[model samples]
Target: MNRCRNWRAAAAIAVAVSSWTGASALSQHKHVSDEELLNLLKDAAPASVFAGATVLNMAPDGTMKVVREGNNGWTCMDPSGTDPMCADAGGMEWGKAYMTKGPAPQRLGFIYMLRGDNGASNTDPYATGETPDNNWIKTGSHVMIVGAEAKSMIQSYPRSPKADPTKPYVMWAGTPYEHLMLPVK
Candidate 1:
């Protein structure tokens, strides 16, 4: 059943990807639709946040001071604010260090990047997350899990995958909140 759902979802993305035919055309639009937001949630925090989530929170540009609660005990903080992300309770703790202008968290946490991704810097914790960075390729469909060991998962793979939106790879390096970029593919 899970496999069937995965296939169906992938099919939908394939269709969506196909529809956004060219670079110029896709760029003209900000990709703001309920479907697009759901896709972002899936990529950013899939294991915790599911497709049937009752509410989809949008925290664009730091409008929400604190993480907003949702029906399933999930915390989402993005409509497009500071990298558009989501997290579970544990992940929220793990990501606190990087969430604001603070130091790295003492322990691990996680987050999701399903919505608008401008890709992220491997070395710069203060990475502006501005799009068009040749380095941090957009995470097509991926999740972030905070753990020092997570770096091993990142080291095992090539960085190229993260640079290409078509592929998947762990993001964040040389920083305190680095994590595993498990691909939904």
Candidate 2:
């Protein structure tokens, strides 16, 4: 009887190990490569409109950073924060998601920013509520985790830009603002 019990226990252990190995193998195939991720970004809508912008790499924390060639060199900008160009909100959120969750199969998040044909410029077209300056365009749907996360930090303003009790705040979405989330693919 004792021998039978030991055999049963050993069989159970073997099954458990086999199950674990199979699950691990499945997970390995699900991982998306950095190059593939970059290609996805290149194919995104508004991001593709930019002249020579390309997807960078995933940061250690999971946030991806992208740099595009301006007239001069490479420039990275985030027009979502109060100090959009310098703020780190987007990077932080991306890192948090990556640390808490494993790598995603597709690109995650969207960030809207101005890409200049010539180079980096100090113009705020969205701020003026007018057409963007020449050579400047609102670009979005990129795979940069940091850039996408930054869009979430933009502030919504009141209709009057002052004390309006009814319509408290207004924020542009899908147009001026960038939408960030996991891609279906």
Candidate 3:
């Protein structure tokens, strides 16, 4: 279906956003075999989701290749190798907007990063590396709630720029792409 393909593309773009962030040794754009990449991305979400989710691998040059096809409306990827994630259509839209520094979608979106991340500056949404004032944090397995609904919860969680990443907190708070990050482990 065209809708399905569109969402897949969105998911690919979403994964690109993660890949563009902090560069860890593992996040480096190294050439990984499709089979190996698929295995690594399997941890991005639960088996139920991963079983039917489309999988993709992104190159350092920003190109994307489909590693697997699925019937489910979810997209999984691990371009950085260190930050595997599975995102739904809404989540993909949010990522696309965030990547372009544009307005976030009005609806809610979900993103799963059960394998954790390579670390990022909590205070600076676009921070590329750790710095004394950047509040760099490496979170464990977690999921994210994005878009307007998540923004509404900003007042319910820790929105401080230096909020702890190990707990439920608002990332990119007070910004158009602000979202809620919830730890699962």
Among the numbered candidates, top lDDT falls to: 3
Q: Residue by residue across 7-60, what tens digits does model 3's lDDT show? A: 556655744575334654334566567888888888889999999987777766
lDDT of 2 by residue, 1-185 (tens): 24333233222222211111112221222223555444443433344333343323333333334433223112123211111111122332333333234332222333332221111111321232223442222222212223333444433432222222122222223333222322222
Scored by Cα lDDT, where does model 2 land?
0.27
Q: Which stretches of candidate 3 lie over 4 Å from their true place?
A: 1-4, 11-15, 19-21, 24-27
> Each model's TM-score?
0.53, 0.22, 0.89
Which model is ahead, 1 or 2, in terms of TM-score? 1
Which order, best to worst by lDDT?
A: 3, 1, 2
Model 2, position 132: C-alpha lDDT score: 41
Steric clash pairs (candidate 3): none
- Worst 10 contiguous positions by lDDT, candidate 2: 78-87
* Residue 89, model 3, lDDT: 77
- lDDT by residue for model 1 (33-135), tens: 4555555555555654654323233322212222122455455433332244555544544544444435545455555655445545544444444445535
User: What's the C-alpha lDDT at position 185 in model 1?
Assistant: 51
Which candidate would rank higher by lDDT, 1 or 2? 1
